[model samples]
Target: MPLPWDSQHFEISVGQIISPALTNSELENILSYAKEQGYHLIYWATCPDRMIPLPLLQSFSGSLVDRKVTYQRKLSTEFTFGEIKNPSHSFEVIEFPRSQANQQLKTLALIAGAHSRFHDDPCISKEKFAGMYHIWINRSTLHEIADVVFIVKNSANMEDCLGMVTGSVKNGIGKVGLMGVQKKVQGQGIGSLLMKTLHEWLISNGIHTSEVVTQKNNIRACKFYERFGYKLESLQHYYHFWVQL
Candidate 1:
């Protein structure tokens, strides 16, 4: 079902539709109706284990956006803490202020790299990506939606933002929402320090398990989380359909 606030079109299928030919026609009709209603983009996701009708999917001129895998790390008393290295790259992680939403948005907009589907999609423009990033960072300000948000900054110059992480607690499980490092300092261990600090903070808040999701094609992100003891839990795929109206 499409959310009332969603502007894009969505269609979902479940429990085998038996007749492939009929299913394909129905899907085509749905797309036509969506186009008539001024929707240029559509999203469709299916059960990971179920057999997807390739002919039906290929019938549309859309692209595969992501193949994501979920990973979880369990905190234990035996866990060890490592030193956040790189003295030349001294930085601090501080709780983000709601008053500084614009500043945060600007920093995130400059992020040249992302592993997520939307950012990696060639069809999506940088302007659209920045708009999406703004919506994401501001979600934490909503009541009961996020527990904490921390931003990484240069210790020598506190106002200079480097990276940020958002987390939430649900049913006693801590989940990483969004985290990214600036492209200029990406490989200098900033991302590692950010996750390490976030893990410690989660543990102190009584969270025994932490989880994060990243596209399987994002090798760097997957490797980074695995180094922090996060194990793969599950995988899912999603398709993105775009048509010019």
Candidate 2:
């Protein structure tokens, strides 16, 4: 599919291959079509069981950028919110107005996408990559992309946001759009508090399941979700193919 948002933002024509698997001949045809349409880059994602061969991909300049993992948790009847244990610092989780925390949230969004696929791809410039996250947070604050946003603040100094998480519910399932804890205060249980707050909000809205996706290389994120009872749902390999035209 044509990625108008990404293309317009990065000033390059971009598209994505929607098929899970493609033969060498099929890929050639797709690339031809992309070039004809003025596409400079194309993204393709494939499951492990249906991946295109490495040799064939290399022939077209397809570079692997990320191994995406999706984790899920069912909010079962036995599920309960555990108290956030923070011996080092006290925190206050609040559902602040989206407009109130736009700047702080945009900073956290940069941290969240620091090691993302866009950042890893050499085809994307640093400024453009940062701009991508900025646009994301801006849309999120407008409630166009995220339904609700939660931030954790130091109780003693409510002006400082230590962590933040954005969530949305659809079809009775909750999805975490972006989440991050400030670097200096990462291990202080602030992330856990933000997550707990999001879960409570989801459950109150009748959402019984939640899912999050992260890069496989982000071990800390994977472990964090696992600690919260989120199980592995699926894994996919992401590749960025830059046309030589």
Candidate 3:
């Protein structure tokens, strides 16, 4: 499938191989189609249990870029906030207007994607990654991509944002979009607080199940979700195939 948004944003013809299974002949046909369409890159994802042969992908110059992990859990009314170690540094979680906190939210968005797959991909420029996150946060604030955004702010200084989380509900299921804590405030239960706020918001909206995806290489993130009671739902291998002239 052609990714028009990505193609236009990155100034490259980009597409994704959505089919999980591919015969050798079908692979050749897909490559031919990409060339005919002047595609510069094609993305493909597969589960570990049903992956395409390494030699087959090697023939097409497909490079493994990320191991994506999906986590999920059912939201319940029986939820409690984790204890905050520093009562002196009190914080409050609130839903803030985008107009009031766009810049801070953008900063948090950059932090969220700092070590993401896009940042790790050598083919994707750093500038492009930054641009992508900026666009994402902007749209998310507009509710074009996400339903709501919550921020954890210092109680003493409302202007001080320690972390933020974005969530959306669809068909009784909630999904986390972007979440991050300021580097200076990380590991102080701020991330857990943001998640608590997110869970409350999701429950209020009648969403009982929530899901999130992260790079497997991000050990901290994986552990964080696991600690929060989210179980591994699926794991996928992502590849980027750059079409050669």
Give me the displacement of residue 141 in model 3, in angstroms. Answer: 1.1
Candidate 1 structure, TM-score to reference: 0.78
- Candidate 1, residues 116-194, lDDT tens digits: the string is 6667777677666666666667666442457777778898888677887778888999988777777777777777777
Give the clash count for each candidate.
Answer: 0, 0, 0
lDDT tens digits, residue span 31-60, model 3: 778877789889878766655667666766
Model 3 vs truth, CA RMSD: 1.9
**TM-score of decoy 3:** 0.92
Ranking by TM-score: 2, 3, 1
Which lDDT value does model 3 have at 98? 59
lDDT of 2 at 235: 96
Q: Which pairs clash inside model 1? A: none
Go through the candidates in order and give the C-alpha RMSD of each one to the true structure: 4.9, 1.9, 1.9
Alpha-carbon lDDT, every model? 0.68, 0.84, 0.85
List ranges where model 3 is wrong by over 4 Å: 50-59, 98-101
What would the TM-scores of all predictions be?
0.78, 0.93, 0.92
Kindly list the per-residue Cα lDDT of model 2 for residues 1-245, writing each as its tens digit. Answer: 99988889989888999997887789878977787777889998888665666766665678889999999998764665466666667788888686744677888998999779999998789899888998887777678888998888887898898888989987778999889888988887888888888888888889889999999999999998999999999999888888753
